[model samples]
Target: MTLLSALFRNQEEVMTFHSRVKLSAYDRDLGLFIVANRDDKPSIKPLRPYQMLVLTTKVKVSDTRKWVEEVFKYRGNTELLQQFMEWEIPKFPVSGHMLKENGVPGGKRIGLVLNKLKEHWADSDFTASSEDLLKQIPTVLSELDIPITR
Candidate 1:
């Protein structure tokens, strides 16, 4: 199965990610989008490429409505989905299988490194190239204590 299948796109799994996903809430301390629960407790999932795909794709309609209705002092013209528009979202330049091909093993750790690289890519204003992202895998593997093979 692809990353979309095994990881992100499970409807029952990621939840209505919009309900928890605070796209507007970027934590300066962590440099990540913060996710808060109904009780106001913080929780986070690794923002793997697939999870991002799932989140972005699903977040549009309902969240637009919520922002339209609830959020206060909003600067936008209107908070309606009918007026929704998407600016450029940078496509992440790498994937789990790409990591595998580069000798990073499978499973949860793939997600961990992908999340790291995604952050790095986004932090670069999406200018980071695939080769730049891929080169980090070895270092990331080492950080995860996965021994690198020749």
Candidate 2:
């Protein structure tokens, strides 16, 4: 059976659908999903795990924007904060429970947290190397007011 079928075999309703089945590969390492059925060829798709989570969970865009502004106040760099919010934040695998614990009532809160983490890792030195920044992820999360537990 194809990957998608194998993954959803127990979902009778989904399995019975008559439309052409689409195949997508989820990359755990990258936290991304690649759609393979487009034009009968596999292509890199911009499906992030957090995007899926956000879709299933209700998120208020206004709240998210407000959180972004709050994060900007803490981080103090509009350009970097915006980039971090748009790109890095969505890559984080966040759950409803985690969001609630972190005072992130919606996607905006999550974005704020992510931006905070990014800023924390930067340690007031925006020129930090990539390797150094990556190593600080866990520490930054732990130090945050609302810790992120795996």
Candidate 3:
């Protein structure tokens, strides 16, 4: 018999193998890390690209969420927080990935960096030009000890 038949002696085994293969494929294609525990067995889930980057930068996931919440609390604007959650936060992973790809520094204190960005954006009278915003990026990066690339 083939490798599949050799590995799965019965119909039940064959089904289980197929199910696992499908789940693994789905996870790989979608950039998702989902875990399901079955039959008292531990499930292993690999880290996603962005998650790995975050870990490498030594940023705690809880700290990031706390910073987001603190900014929301400081502003006391539900609508603005909603917009940030709906729009900006989702883009963070993609942005992080791009920065990593470009050899940009990943600072250890990502929470502080995020808080600064939030403060800049939250200012009611703040009207920074695109160039001004770009300049601020390097400043934040420097504060985080992330090397500035030309």
Candidate 4:
């Protein structure tokens, strides 16, 4: 069976998805990132683990359904939503929770949070501080057992 299938079949495995911080026009700052789940075991030949793609674009009025479809397309093997609630969100720093858990800050979760923030901002009595918005994203990125600038 493929690694994807195996990983799926065994749900208890702890697999890490790695990404290199690179440049991209997709976001204004922090650059765009490419995430590689180590379990995929992509080969050097054509059609790499790049087999699947999930793209999340921001929208103002409503939740983007595309995020739901795309995430499931590539993430069916992993219980992504469950992990979001269980591990990713609760364990990470609050700011990182929304970003990493929901695939936001860089993916769909960012959009979702932004939408909520907008709603809260619209309320005259509920105003969040700027620091509140920047709370989760660490100014420094920790990886490879080292600290690097984010």
Best by lDDT: 1
Residue range 1-150, candidate 2, lDDT tens digits: 223332433334342432344422212111111111111222242222222233233345444433333433333446634543675332333334554454444555456555554444333333444455445555544565545444
Ordered from best to worst lDDT, the candidate numbers read: 1, 3, 2, 4
Pairs that clash in candidate 4: 95-136, 104-110
lDDT of 2 at 119: 49
What is the per-residue lDDT of model 3 for residues 1-150, given as tens digits with 9 covering 90 to 100?
A: 122333443455545655666644422211111111111222232212222222333445554443443334443546644654553322222244344444455564445555454444433123444344444666777776666554
Backbone clashes, each candidate: 0, 1, 0, 2
Question: In lDDT terms, how accurate is model 1?
Answer: 0.48
Q: What's each prediction's TM-score?
A: 0.46, 0.22, 0.27, 0.20
How many backbone overlaps does candidate 4 show? 2
Candidate 4, after superposition: displacement of residue 124 in Å?
A: 3.6
Error of 2 at 70 (Å): 21
Candidate 2 has which clashing residue pairs, if any?
Answer: 64-108
Better of 2 and 4 by lDDT: 2
Model 2 regions more than 4 Å off = 1-110, 121-124, 145-150
Query: Considering lDDT, which of the candidate structures 2 and 3 is the better prediction for this target?
Result: 3
**Candidate 1 lDDT, tens digit per residue, 1-150?**
111122333344334442465423311111111111111222253222322332233345344334322211122224321223333345678987788888876787777778777766765657899999898888777777886543
- Output the better candidate (1/2) by lDDT: 1
RMSD values, in order shown: 12.8, 16.6, 15.0, 16.4
